[model samples]
Target chain A: MGKILGGDNMKIVMVEPINISMMKIEEYRQQLEAEGHQLIAYSSRAENDQEMIKRVKEADILIIANQPLSAKVINASKDLKMISVAFTGFDHIAMEACRENDILVSNSSGYANQAVAELAFGLVINLMRNIKDSDGAVRVGKTRKNLIGNELFGKNFGIIGFGSIGQKTAKIAAAFGCNILVDDHKQHKLGEELGVEYLPIDKLMQE
Target chain B: MGKILGGDNMKIVMVEPINISMMKIEEYRQQLEAEGHQLIAYSSRAENDQEMIKRVKEADILIIANQPLSAKVINASKDLKMISVAFTGFDHIAMEACRENDILVSNSSGYANQAVAELAFGLVINLMRNIKDSDGAVRVGKTRKNLIGNELFGKNFGIIGFGSIGQKTAKIAAAFGCNILVDDHKQHKLGEELGVEYLPIDKLMQE
Candidate 1:
């Protein structure tokens, strides 16, 4: 079996719960253990920064769900070489501290792209159609007032982020015959491929 | 050319304002008129049921956003044949009355499936990791306290309604390493193909 750092087995500790299904955890754990790594999982709240530091003091790799690791916690852990985050948003963790200590940080990306983009479209339709509000009125035995909603057939859709999620959103928007406008930090060639218009963030936001 | 029964072009009454960038109502109206149908668009609330009824009495097709059409309004329209709803949910309309009157009522169903399902997954992860709650805390300049979230790998995903929307949801859930359990009105072979276990509604709800 493969090993980390020429060791027979690597000891990895989860700093917090990774918001995923139990089966997924078991699967990942099995895969890791098969490769000669020991996985330690905890489902309790860290009592304090000190408690967290103490628990991870012996871990070779630390996997965090959403918990923030302070400079002190990183400094206290002498054996930590890698930090794998389950969530995409990494604004919580002190990256500078991890960098200073030479701890590798990895975050999950492109997993929730389809899910987040789909939800944004659903919310827009829900807001436009008042489906929930009408359902609430009917559920309470109130006289049903038909709330008029507009068709999404030909609307303008402005996407803020042109990441994987944004591209997926644009595809769905196109299927509904929407005119798409995308604003992103990086230059997007999708405008030519998907018939989307690229606009500056400030100008796009204004419209 | 196609012609209305009354010889004059048939009118299409729109109840609410719709964002029409890709497909303009005027374009549709002209196309319909070329085929010998008139289009009359409305964007005002009904002062009273009588006023609303009078406006819609001669309409061949009624286009609504979310305004509720009571049974009274349905009965008042002597020439109404079709009601095209812009949104997905049709709970606001009087389905029984429309059935009795032979007035066809159709709503957008598969349009926002991807969007809504995406949101559900996003919410699941966000709630599990306390991302939004943590972001709110950090925005106020509070010291970060990491919350533990469950890993999504190898979890049981119970899905209701195995239609296009539910199936789409199952596909995304599978990408996250979830074992899907589906509940639907009709037997679906797709569930078996996707390796999703089919269960009764009661059992699904209980789980």
Candidate 2:
């Protein structure tokens, strides 16, 4: 296999990586090693900065998911050329260090947009129907003392920031027979398609 | 108020009824009393046959819900001309004594069909999402360890009875993106309207 950049095998380290991927860490390691790169992965969170520093000291590539990649860890490594985060947000990463070191930063952004939307709708049901409260009651054999619930068959649901996440949430709410109202800086086809009316943010807040 | 037969006010007794009714027992009694029928509503269960006998002694009409109107209670009252059960089922009341004494039995059937159906669907989401278990976890500050849950995006749901309750559950399931299969003695328009498939009892059991 031709080496990347025609140099010695590149060292890759992933810190506190999660199992949300389709492939396991070992399989990813094997695939990267076959392509002439060394892969090191920590399946669990590092206890301290020292532990994180030790793992990424020789890494040419650093991968992280959700766990904070503090400036201390990033400054400890001069060899890192790229920081890969397996999530939509990059706020937890030390972007300043990467910029100073000429390191590239990439994230799997928009990957969980649909998932986020689905959970929002589910949580609404969870809250309205008193699901969690009733469950605790059942466990203690005191079910329904204060377990009265409200239905979501015909309810008003408001959405802000009508992006992918907001659009997905709207679809689920539509299925629930909810009258969805959206307020955003820019309008999209999602509102008309879902039969959700676009209203002024001020108007939405009042009603 | 003039009586129907120029007779004294009718004595009516309700024994240990439940709160599953659409209208509260007191509210129904107030409506009945407004129409000149005497209402004696029990707020608690009758412990023994004598207790039940004492409650319905001079009653011209009897009302019950969930509590057992034993044969002894029925035989004790020769004045009863009607049994006004505040629910759909009549299994708890004594049918034999009513037959012998020529007493008319009536129940408030289909009163709670919508409420029952709405709750049934709410419970499905409650169970699938582990909302209750997670709530218990959060209450004790053990949030989300071994409390992983599944979404109801696409699943197979089987309904044993396609009456109001089952059909209503199917509608909610469809909202949650489920493929519904119903098994009943007779075919129903509910399946067609909801785009659910009706399967034979044996076939449904296998699938």
Q: What is every candidate's alpha-carbon RMSD to the true fold?
A: 10.9, 5.7
Each candidate's TM vs. the true structure?
0.50, 0.72
TM-score of 2: 0.72
**In terms of DockQ, which candidate is strongest?**
2
Residue A75 alpha-carbon offset, candidate 1, angstroms: 2.8
**DockQ, 0 to 1 scale, candidate 2:** 0.25
Error of 1 at A111 (Å): 2.2
Q: Report the error of model 1 at residue A185, Å.
A: 1.4
Complex DockQ, candidate 1: 0.06
Give a tens-digit lDDT track for model 1, residues A68-124: 778888888888888888888888888887888788888998777755765565556
Docking class of 1: incorrect
The TM-score between candidate 1 and the true structure equals 0.50
Error of 2 at A196 (Å): 2.2
